[model samples]
Target: MPKPAPGLPTREQILDFIATSSTPAGKREIAKAFGLTAQQKIILKAMLKDMADEGLIDSAPGRAFHKMGGVPKVTVLRIVDADDGGNVWAVPENWHAETPAPRLRVRERKRGALGVGDRILARTEEAGNGWIAHPMKALARGEELILGVLRQEGSKLWLQGVEKKERREFQVSDAGEGKPGDLVLAEKAGRPPRITARVTEVLGDPFAPRSFSLIAIHKLGIPTVFSPETIEGAEKIAKTPLGEGFGENGREDLRHVPIVAIDPADARDHDDAVWATSDDDPKNDGGWKAIVAIADVSFYVRPGSDLDREARRRGNSVYFPDRVVPMLPEILSADVCSLKQGADRAALVCHMQIGKSGELKSWRFTRAVVRIAANIAYEDAQAAIDGQIDHPLTDTALKPLWACWRALYKAREKRSPLDLDLPERRVVLDEKGRIMSVAPRERLDAHKLIEDYMIAANVAAAKALEAKKAPVMYRVHEEPSREKLVALKDYLKTFGVEFALGQVVRPATFNHILDKVGEVDFRQQVMEQVLRTQTQAYYAPANHGHFGLALGSYAHFTSPIRRYADLIVHRALVSAYKLGPGGLTEGEAAGMERIGEGISALERRAMEAERDTIDRYVAAFLAERVGQVVETRITGVTNFGFFATVEGIGGDGLMPVRDIGGEYFRFDEAARKLVGEHSGTEYASGQRLPLRLAEANPVSGALRFEMVDGKGAAPERDVKPARVIKRRGRPANIRHQGRKR
Candidate 1:
């Protein structure tokens, strides 16, 4: 509640009123606006006077005591209406704390705020006195705080404390005597500038804050972020192919594999396609067979051409909250080489065999021009498999494909393969790129068919490298790091499930754990956490074999369209076995190795940039659902808040530490939790709990979650458990957030 027309109301009430206002208003205006009366006015004036003493606010030039225009928006939102009415008006992210913590917080708006070149952290306060703030830590000792001060007001400085307050007359920090109003520059002095000051250096009024964030990102040179120049250069190199004249040099032809690609309904670039079935081919005893055809990107993207030069520079495509900074331009990623429906395109095909007993019978790799019979969405093909979607592809030719998918699933189960599949959440957007809704993306049987075949092809690549003794960069997924495993074991122990943390944890152990806990209510959360413990598998010359797929050897081979490594690997295989680039010069191999490393580094950065973009979209999606409570599973625990996997959405967000008001919580780094020092209030990782959706900022991609008792609430149950969704390059699609909330 806003202090009623301020008849000298309490500081608490005044603060609350300030927090609630969405727009800046005069003190008297606020009083009149909110209906503050007689004594309340007196009390409010005194409170504002005290805050003025603290340099938190300054009265407007030539303005009377009751008039407004002094409050620093940042501090106003800090303590005002922070409780009770909910911190609605925010600075664009969770919390207004001034700590060095990585979380975004509210900083102050300057004189020329909202103008070009004038950077200010935005803060919002509704008329109800609710406020939310995000802080910016840009000022440092000796650094310049450049700002164009717009207005000058008759404001006096007073020093104030809880019991007593006094006025103070001081000289202006700016060179000239601080006049009624003057834009001035404030350099950080002996120590870092105070976090509370709104105006640092007043540059001038006519300036802009437009695209300030992008500028900062570029200036800071954060390794993960990329510039437009970097993106532009890489795109050009992707257009020209390297080894062009060698197409007819004796590579095996599998142009008639009847291959099809099944990706998310929203996927644009198709990289890998599969045609799988029972092949009684006389190569060995009759067995199930797979022909995994990948878009032959290297065939067109040369090593040092303009296209290759840009590709080399970008390393890979970068994704941001609302957009994609593609490594290759749309000309390549989605067109020319895109394996779209009914397109006869060139590819590097991996022919593989799986025995009846769920074993890799045999495999072969070849490069050729292949035709895609169809391009189907994962769900559509899954519908075809489940008999829910009776489409032409299923009736005309996919029935046998369905059989192959079933066989692959069986092979996966019998092999005790590591099921690293996690739910995927898609953030749907409207025309202007605003997130309209968040929905879960399913992984159907048809998805498994493609996944299994890709795995086979990957293994084939790894095997070929091993056979020729080539120092190729393999996509090695080593065992979970010991530290991660220990933390995981501790987390599970809190749940009373003693996982065997012996000398080693094999893939089968995870599979076993999944089987044992699959029927439990909180199993979804547990499974994803277990999945998270596994380090992100990466490419290296040293083969650490992927544990998740239960494969002896593996490398990404079927997505050259989106991944540079796939292109390199495709070139290596073709040269080694087909076109004869057999032996590398010492210098050549070293150069390729160096190139691999560069590409790997860029790949990581691009992935981060992509995640950053997705995060922003998801944040926007969640912000629209304030006050909605959903059953959720705690996927991670942090000091700030616990992150949850909501039921239907494949996304994650934080349940902020401050919003969880019931008890003072501490995160147990060993086990990942926030527990009350007293009252035994505990929020454990992987615990299914009810989270009241509080705030989500799309711009910063931050989520604020609140935890409440979920005792009687039904545990979040998944309709179809977590599964990995592949989109043929960059980072894999990670869906989450449907843990019921």
Candidate 2:
């Protein structure tokens, strides 16, 4: 290399110097070695800063300028794509700021060795002006626990993986005395077609009732049992009653307020309560002041303690249909911290004043001590409000809550949020845990009232923390992607409903499309498709403005006993406003970004686990009803198969392509339809048909259905979308809507 003895070195010269240097280079040393003047040093400084900003060099370690990461000679990568011609491409696992990270082609021998979503550590070299990689080792899948079924094939044992995306089977030498059809846990060794495993445990037989949830719980690695240390810590705290930590220093006595908690009929742990009264001051005539009090979990679960550590690890509580894996021990979530009637409990309170026009005028937060006046279920409260039942407490206690709900409802109407009405199913169980029946849950005004109250409180908490300029984890939802809109528009075109594409659209645009759904017969199908096009909401440190609720800022602030995110928000408010003990610490503030990401990941994991558990339960319920005719709707279609969701039961099943008919099907990806080649028969979404339950496998949570009366193959025809007939009155068949508490 040419010796750097110039006034100002070029970019190429700088790169070459650093590449050849054995020692780390600093600006002062670089300037001295290059013989640069004072003005030239400034130019070099600017160039280095620009380079560092572009990720060409590291600037974190003060003046020691080091080359940033690039494609390493030996690095780990994930196989992202494989072509029909047997060419496999991968990108670096730990790459820097490069968008669409540089791809490397694998050697021909290793091209088809790994499947999609597999990771590999490889040795790479620059070749043919591109890059070539040779796999040195295959990285193991991240999941520590392997869930599968023990299969006996002619006296040889194998473990069939449970995951839908994974296909490889493991050979088991030691079966742990597990029989065929039993769910098993195996320790996998080696890779690909030659992988081996040893059965460590034999879960129950898959066909047994209620065994589905147990299998899913272990398969997903959800922690169900608490450790002895954690239990001891909980018991020690539980020994103290609710009033042991309360004092007048920073706590407000709200015992005089007649607050009541509204929850589900079978709810065991109540974490929130509401009380509202007419604003007495003339400045707020015809208005109301609503107070929402949440259980003060932080007061007992302090930072760096055993309880706090375990709660943080679990992130939040997970509830299956049959049981719950609580974030805190039952002693806290169900007893001390639960907002039970007539019980004095610690609370974090949000007080909001609304105007006659239903707009919020002001709001504040406080640490409080409260006594709940009564406990009411949603159904009973609605009945009381409607005057259908002559309840003694209706005029005395429930009237004020209904009044406040009226004003809040007005404000919600003015807000015009994205409202997609999709009723959920609740499965009832008998004493022995067998599914008795499944029905759609009723959406009562009382439920909406409590939801409005919680939403207002959550928003106020976010606003209060933001006004104080404190670090906060916001509940955010972004606008849907353009690609999703394009596909949604195509689907909408099938119904002769036009979607204004390639423009800046608002939530109201979706509301408009949904409004037109009543003009068609497939209301449920259209709503499901519309919901799939929207973005999922999540937690983050930066504010992204929730699209679904149409709120500029929002956060989870209720139910601290169940959700850790709410607890974190409470701590941030306490620290920001100088509330006593259990405030957010400096260490937590500095790591809030990482904390948000960790808790968001935990939230997704909990959602997936719950969904899987429910799927298993539904499949087990349907296993007994095989060969019975059921109403089904086509939810998705592809060349390989079509997925249908059963009516009333809400269980989804697959009807394979061969079973649809003995004909080749052409898949139209954009239109999301499958067309038969021989008969020109079409299978599309939003189509309702009758089917018989062919099989229900609880082990894999798989439900299979076969079309009845040869109705699987239907000829395509141009038919007008029919308008739905509006119902006259509320039907007597009211179902209890199972909600995620």
Candidate 3:
């Protein structure tokens, strides 16, 4: 038996060692520092375990120890929030404690200013008042945190991902006091097969309706709660009244114009309104004069203000089935800035002269105070124009808008934009938060009328900025790359369609291709490929023409209440037209490139979160119909499996390759198809097949399908089996074999 050391450290001494250790202090390190014998080391291990049970010290990976409710001495920190005084605060990038993470005031060093969404390696210290962090060095932004549900299998705990595309489960290293079946926010710590994570937060039941969006909000790090300072600023701005005066204080009164706001019935905020009339001038006969009044958000949320900072961070409002996370506070987004009917509101108006051919002849911008004549829903406006409903505002508003749209449609047809029939699915929910129905929203002429007018206004804004030689944040969608177009051409050739690579591509080129394949079985498949071949749109200071709209100049000038990019354009117009206060500052113009990039990234973040929430809602709606057969169409094909979505109820499900039949299938990369080795059975994308709803996991939003006709097997052949091809460092099933022509 080994003898105990002469002196053993007290519990307080051990706690101090852990709290102040520069590196992860494990049991061996502690033993060496104390010069303890073998028996004394055993005693020290017992003490550490007792401390963990008592909730005094946390046992981290590699047997490291730290105080409960405390971060490591040197660890990664993410900037989360900032004060009105420019003091930034951060939290541990991978916090795993029961209590809320303690905010650390970052001490600005020579390293430079740290803004929100920045990551840094900092040395943390527990000060007398609170925690403080000093920058050691800056670090690149880390991977996004994972949101999942904790599940226990025997002695092991696992985190099941909530995203539809996440198929593998993560092994949990620390549960952070979370239990099985609890929704959690975790961070990845290790790689696959033995993938590990540490739980950072314990959210409630995953099956709840509100939890679906909440999961997405947290997963994407979306800012849901507004700062008190920002909210107060919005309220203060909302209280300022618009004085009654025409052409005074740089504001024009256009209250006499019968302007109308048309939007969705469920829309909470109305930001734009339109009015138009026939031109009486003989020289401009058959022309129309129009006004587009958008909410002047820049007037309220000015540069360098708390409200402006918050709006810029949010970029745009995120709309979900249950709620909307607005860019501005509700006091401004839904009440003050919103163009409510019979209410006087501040607006930035665009005046345009359109000729008979719908060509914009001239345009100007001005600040104005206008009263919205009426706020009509799209369905009601369409019904009124169809003579199905006798409405008072139909002749005053609906008919004139439709007449203007008729002329605009002529120009739109001449432009020939890349038109794709992509139907959007809408989820309807009851007051109790239960889903009522999920269906495709019907397209209407009323929607198109508003869209065309908005497009004209946006073009005018961009062109006006260019005339002033001012910086413009152009909405850019460049043409597809040669690689994608080549792949697309190969895919089309399978159907015997011709595509010339040497020709200069235009939106009309894609339109012609679709027209050639009109209403065929593979038209939807071809459309999907065309969409995949298009480039993603983004905002940039340098102008790159919008390929999708076929517009040489385009900027977002509508819906300033929801979009920050529109707000920036409004400020630019105010600056260029000398429309008085809230004009773009010199500093803002200088930083336009950086601002554009940041807002573009934020926009993508909002889109991803919104799409993910919708997927979760769809999965929840279909959870009750498991085991029933559903009509599905193959949306994509891969080496491992094929993905299909329900005909109407939209949620993609995977049909594994192994479950299809008892035969080896070879994947054709160029053709996007899979063929059985012996039976020669072929399955390709865009094909319709009946599949059974095998599995639907609402928590993960994952679905699995099976063939309704039962597993297919190849007939026995009295011949030698096909030669198996083996490749080093490749899976046996995924190895490609030469095919006989």
Best by TM-score: 2
Local distance difference test, each candidate: 0.56, 0.77, 0.83
lDDT string for model 1 (79-175, tens) is 1112122222222222222222121223334421221122233343323333234434332222223322223334542111100011222223333
Q: Model 3 over residues 1-741: C-alpha lDDT tens digits? A: 122336777788788778767777888878877778888988998788667656688755345777877777777899866666667789987654557988999998842377665799998888886899999999986655788999899999999888766767888999988899999988765322334789988998899877888988898888989999998989998887654232356578899999999999999999999999887889877688899999988888899999999999999999989999999999999999999999889999999988888988899998889999999999999999999998888887778878888888888989988999888889999999899998888889999899999999999999999999988888989887666788889989987889998899999999999998889878988998999989778887878789999999999999899988899999999888878778898998998877887788788888988888888888888888888889999988887768989888888888877667777887666567778878988778888888888888777677788878767222233323234344555323343334334
Candidate 3 TM-score, true structure as reference = 0.78
Q: In model 2, which range of ten residues has the least summed lDDT?
A: 730-739
Question: Candidate 2 residues 611-687, lDDT tens each?
Answer: 78777777777888888888898888754568998887777888866567655565655466767667877778877
* Candidate 1 RMSD to the real structure: 22.3
Top candidate by lDDT: 3
Superposition error at 6 for model 1 (Å): 86
RMSD in order of candidates: 22.3, 11.1, 17.6
| Steric clash pairs (candidate 3) | none
TM-score per candidate: 0.62, 0.79, 0.78
Question: How big is the positional error of residue 719 in model 3, measured in Å on the Cα after superposition?
Answer: 27
Better of 1 and 2 by TM-score: 2
Ranking of candidates on TM-score, top first: 2, 3, 1
